[model samples]
Target: MLHHQAIITDIKAIIAQSQEKAIRTIDHQRTLMYWAIGERIFREEQQGKDRADYGQHLTAYIAQALEPELGSGFSKRQVELMRQFYRTFPIANTLYSQLSWSQYKLLLRLDSHDQRTFYMAETVKNNWTVRQLERQIYTNLYERLLVSNDKESVLAVAQNEQLPSDAKQIIKDPMFLEFLGFRRESAFYEKDLETAIITHLQEFLLELGNGFSFVARQKRIHIEGDDFFVDLVFYNRLLQCFVIIEIKTAKLTHQDLGQLQMYVNYYDRVEKLPHENATIGILLCADKNDAVVRYSLPAGQKQIVASQYKLYLPTEQQLLAELNKELYSFEKGE
Candidate 1:
């Protein structure tokens, strides 16, 4: 009876695996078809380069004719997307077979060649779902990295050409938590905010950027008979270290930095293995004075960082202000 049951389970597993592979193959073929269509349109447009506005007219005519015969995917905007897609990708041979139509559609929206390439390399490297990719874009992850590191390093790290030596290289300040379903006006305790992050742990990890895996919440530590609970703990495989995170509901202060430094010290002395890198600590709070943070940590401190968190997506102006502020401060070592 046991043998029979095992055989049945194995058969079911094989069938499921086969179906998954079949779907992937079909999606790849569909992607290729779109690429081929794009190539044809691009070649036609190139041939008619002598005529002013011919490309626009050609695309419009193609959309009108294709929509009636083939359906929704060939609409005006989408046909243009196909054209842009081909132009951006250029070589059909270089198209990533693992990507779906939806992923390609999102990639088309990025404005810069470098940005598109970085995001694509990361998307493939991280095996991100469409939702995760969308969230990364809205959070402006690429720009955040650029502010911290040189352009060459940023591109290199994105494509896995170099490893991150400091946690700040990968960490984003004022991480967006709009996915937590909390209103910006909502008043909450640190515990309440921590609870929300724990509840939406997956999204939080995604927002935390790559190579992070959750370990514990409200992790308890004892020192000279006093007990303290770290709000969250995670291990970053890429960094080869443990990350201790503390949550703060209001403005950050030197006291908070001291508390975080203690945690980092504890992890480095006790939790970190000889083979592992020094553990890092992040004090995630609702607001921060950059001057305060700058002065709080010792000169050449490597293990502790403070960053703010927001309940809603910041406006373009707000983000721009932050980028300028951070760029100046980070360069000044403040």
Candidate 2:
């Protein structure tokens, strides 16, 4: 009976493996087909550069004609996408099916070859979905890397395995939180924001950058005679530490810092495993007193960090301005 069961398990495993292999093969073939269409369209377009309007019309004409014969994938937009796809990646060997059409569209918009390559490599290495890839690009992931890391490390992250130590190196301080759509001028409570974050946990984590995995919402701790709760607890696989996060809707104060310090101390003393490093704390507040944070924490302390969150996505101009600020500081050797 055991032998029969083993044989059945082996058969099921084989079937699963075959199915996965077949899926990969189909994906590869479909991507190659798209690349071929792109190549043909691009070559034709190049020959008629003098007739600029004709180029757009040609794609629509081809898509309209192909629809009845070829089926669903050939819309006018998709045909234009095919042309852009070839223009973006002329080398068919480099095209990866792991990246969807949406991701390709986003990548093709990047002006720099190195920037596009970096994002492609990271997106594949991290297995980021189309939405995740778009979010990273829109958030200026490439620019953020240029600001935070040396060229070598930045390239390594873009090309190779995403190591845990590199998480903070990639994270942007004062991450824009405008996606939440909270009114800065309104009297929204901290709990209100926290609830929203919990409701949209996946988006929140993506905005939080990489390496963070949600551990708990309102995690409880008991110390001596009192009970305390942390708003969020996450573990950064790369940093190898438990991250205790405190949320505040108002400006950060010394008292807030002290409370976070207490949480960090508690985790270090009681909750942290022997192999794990000391816990780190983050104060995600609506506002911050940078001076208070600087003087309140011990010098050269890497464990605790304070960053403000925004509830809306900023304009491209705002993003560029912020990028310039980081770049200027780096150039000044600050």
Candidate 3:
């Protein structure tokens, strides 16, 4: 009986795998079909280059003729999108086979070439679904990463040219916890936020960046009869270090930094193996003063990072303002 059950399970697994492969194959073919359509439309437009509105008229004419026979997929708006798609990705070879038409539509909305490239690489690397890719784009993950690192480093890491050497390469400051469903106006304690994180741990890990696996929560350590509990502990495989996160619902102070530093020291000395790199400590706080964070840690300190957590996603304008503020401070060599 057990052998028969195992055979049934194996057959089910094979069927599931084959179905997934068929779906991927169909999506890839659809992407290729769209690309071919876009290329043909673009070639037709170029033949009438002297006419200013030729491309627009040509697209509408084609859409009207095709929609009657091929249905609404060839509507004017979608046709225009196809034209833009070809313009955005001129080289057919550069199109990623793994991305579906829906994902490409979201990518088409981005204005910057570098931003598009970064998202494309990340979507493939992370196996991001259409909704996940949309959320990342809407959250402005590319711009958020750029706030700390340079463009080249961000692109290089996304392209897998090099492994992440520093946590800052992947971690974002002002981490968004809106998915935790906490209201911005409501008051909450650190434990409440921690519970919310634990409940929505998967989204938190996605927001936490790559290669992070949960280790423990409220991890206890005893030293000379004194006991202490770490709020959250995680392991980052890429950086090969343990990440200790301490939640602070109020503005960050030097004392908070000191406490986190102590935890980091303990991890380095006791928990970290000889082959592992130094443990990293992040103070996830509600607000922080940049100067205080700078002066709190010792000179040339790289292990401890203070990042703010937001209950809501910031608007593009707000992100721009924050980016500008960081850029101004960086320019002053601060």
lDDT of each: 0.86, 0.81, 0.91
Instruction: Name the regions of candidate 3 deviating beyond 4 angstroms.
Output: 49-52
Model 3 clash tally, residue pairs: 0
lDDT score of residue 127 within candidate 1? 82
Best TM-score among the predictions, by candidate number? 3
Pick by lDDT: which candidate is best?
A: 3
- RMSD for all candidates, in order, please: 2.1, 4.3, 1.4
The parts of candidate 2 lying over 4 Å away from their true place are: 1-28, 41-80, 179-184, 289-291
Tens digits of per-residue lDDT, candidate 2, 1-334, equal 9999999999999999999778767877777788899899877877885657878978999999997788868988788888878878889888877776667888988898878887898788778887888888887877776775765677676575546464446565667776677775777777888888888888787778666799998899998889999999999876788988899888899999999999999999988999887798889987897779989999878778787777777888898799889878877876
| Rank list by TM-score | 3, 1, 2
- lDDT digits (tens) for residues 3-26 of candidate 1: 999999999999999998898789
| Better TM-score candidate (2, 3) | 3
Q: Report the error of model 2 at residue 306, Å.
A: 1.8
Give residue 244's lDDT in candidate 3 (0 to 100): 98
